[model samples]
Target: MGVHHHKIGGGKLLIAIVLNLILTVVQIVGGIISGSLALLSDALHNFSDVSALTISHVAHTLSSKKATVKETFGYKRAEIIAALFNASVLIAIGIYLIYESFVRFYDPQPVVSVWVVGLGMLGVIVNGGSIWLLEAEAKGNMNIRAAYLHLLGDTLTSVAVVAGGAAMYFWHIYWIDPLISIAIALYLIYASLSLVKESTGVLMEFVPEDLDVEEIAEAVAREPDIKNIHHLHIWRINDREVFLQAHLDFEQNLSLQEVTRRIEKIEKMLKHRFGISHAVLQPEFMRDDEKDLIKGES
Candidate 1:
């Protein structure tokens, strides 16, 4: 199932790259001819999108490699690494756009034909198409979703640039050029910050948002033979793979095999109910409760 989902994600990323490359060329030429810094900045932003999509494609391919003896987890972390790289690129682009917008605000430049502005409107349409193509897969994967949001922001910025161009053409209000650029920069900041937060959370191996640790402890404690549960740990190896480890104290006089059966049941229950597939339960006799299964803890 993981491999199937990744293949779909890779296909979507390839489509996005092709569309974005086409749009970037169009925007660059249109921006240069029109002397619109807003259009030019957006073109550069799309160029960054191209890089981001490429990274996502490579990461998806690497993530599907079978596990080797040296690396038991295989290459799943490649996707997470790619997600972090994408977020970093977003931050860089956002900062550069913000700086350029400030520079243009102080020295606003003349914008040319409304025809060039019309070209930018076409860019908005293309970006919208790219967003729709990736939106379905983004729901299940963060890396692709970040790329989608970036394109979405660029699409909106293209609309703003077109509106600003139309205003300037009809009214000779050159200041709208810098104003539109500022709006695009702000949008980039908003979207990039969200991407950074999500990527960081995943890299930190935080518990999956839907699984509450306290609730899990309570559930395990409810087992008929369980005396207590402690030293519980739950975290994700990636978005889809969750790992849990804990010490299970069994009631006195339970056979070893019986205790093993109970632990196996708990593992199955966790997988079925909470999406946790890799769980390690260490059973301890009630008399040995004072001794710690995990060393180096007080």
Candidate 2:
């Protein structure tokens, strides 16, 4: 299911990648000729969009590959890795923009407002279209969301450039260039932080933020003939797929057939209640073991 979904995302990413690659070159040249720091900052941000989209495209492609014995989970996590990489780049670029803005604040340079306004208008159109293209898929997929954010940030920066250009043209307020750059940097940092936190949490094997182990155990305990559930662990394979493992103690020394039927019911309960995609439960009857829900020295 994930592979098919990624295949659809691939087409949108390809279009965005090509568009951003072209826009990056145009913005860089335009920024240089216009002497607009804000325009240069937008160009740098656009370049990151190109790189991020490319990474996402590759990840989507890799995710479509079948699982092998060597890599049992397949490449579903490729998109998660791409999301991490994109968010990290966003932070680095944001820091760089802020530093550049401080330098510009000290010694503001005069810009050609005509060139700045004209190129910034073109940027708005290009980035806006890219945002529209990716908006539908961005809702559910973190990789797409990061790429969408790159385009959204670029759109906002382009708007800022247009405003700054007007300000410079009317009042000769050169410092507005740095001010707009600073605003763009702050926004990028704010937007990228959650993606960075989520991706890092997944990489570190932390339990998914929305899930509660105790709540899950309590829910499962409601089933018939269940003595207790313990030694339970849950984690996500990606944004959509969650895997669980646990020990299930039974009240009766049931037959193998009865145990299988009971286990099937519990699996269904987990799937319906918790959205767990895979479950590996160890069934036990009248066996002595550590009964803690979380079985480890705390």
Candidate 3:
């Protein structure tokens, strides 16, 4: 029926956004003064995280709107769109950081070790707090998942910066800074690509990966008075909810009341067998038509 809102409060997200913005500015300035590319990269990632969280918060609000004639689905897909945008941004930032890290390798700059270490440790604390705040909501929502990934990336990058700073300070290994940046960028890319693919699937209305249309049709045909099932379609509303639609052929022409009862039975079967949250069915009697399990493109 309806989407369930997580127990998370807008106040918690607002707190996270404020913290990230303040720390991002601090890190950027510190990166410039300290000449730390790793620190600068972490700051950039933190900035992206801030942007992602703001988009998610707005989408979460929009998703609560009711459906209308012009927008039959209302703003339900807003969160999915936000998730796609956030994932795309993460991938772009990751690529830029990787390229920058490679360039830095050729001309490694000497960073002030104390500044990098101090800012990095502060980053870890700040990002860790933000992660805690969004952890619960992220589990069931793709938009929140993108935001969570950003914070998790930032936390990991902060740790990397600290490690690189320590290595450079003790052993004078300046190359470690770019090395850590490269590693963080690669990891971010790897993690965010999955989100991009999943969000894209939803936007494209692709069938859920776990569902088998043939199996569902066979199961529905098992009900008495049902001749066959065809024109089956399934897709996700978001990460948690699934929507299914299909046409059913019956052995006999039934009254409106009997048809309604059969429809309810089919809906219950779909929900129990496939975790389908919503279903639409069209009943037919001895209609001559194609009965393909999946409708082929004309």
Best by TM-score: 2
Q: For candidate 3, lDDT tens digit of each residue in 41-111?
A: 99999999889889988888788788899988878889899999999999999899989999999999888
lDDT of 2 by residue, 25-132 (tens): 998999999999999999999999999999988987887788999998889899899999999899899999999999999999999998888888988999999999
Please, what is the TM-score per model? Answer: 0.91, 0.97, 0.96
- Residue 74 in candidate 2 has what lDDT? 87
**What C-alpha lDDT do the candidate models reach, one value each?**
0.81, 0.90, 0.90
Better of 1 and 3 by TM-score: 3
Pairs in clash, predicted candidate 2 = none
Residue-level lDDT tens digits of model 1 in 84-167: 787777777778877877888888777895855787788788888888888887777777777887788889888888888889
Question: Roughly what TM-score does model 2 have, to 2 decimal places?
Answer: 0.97
In every candidate, how many clashes are there?
0, 0, 0
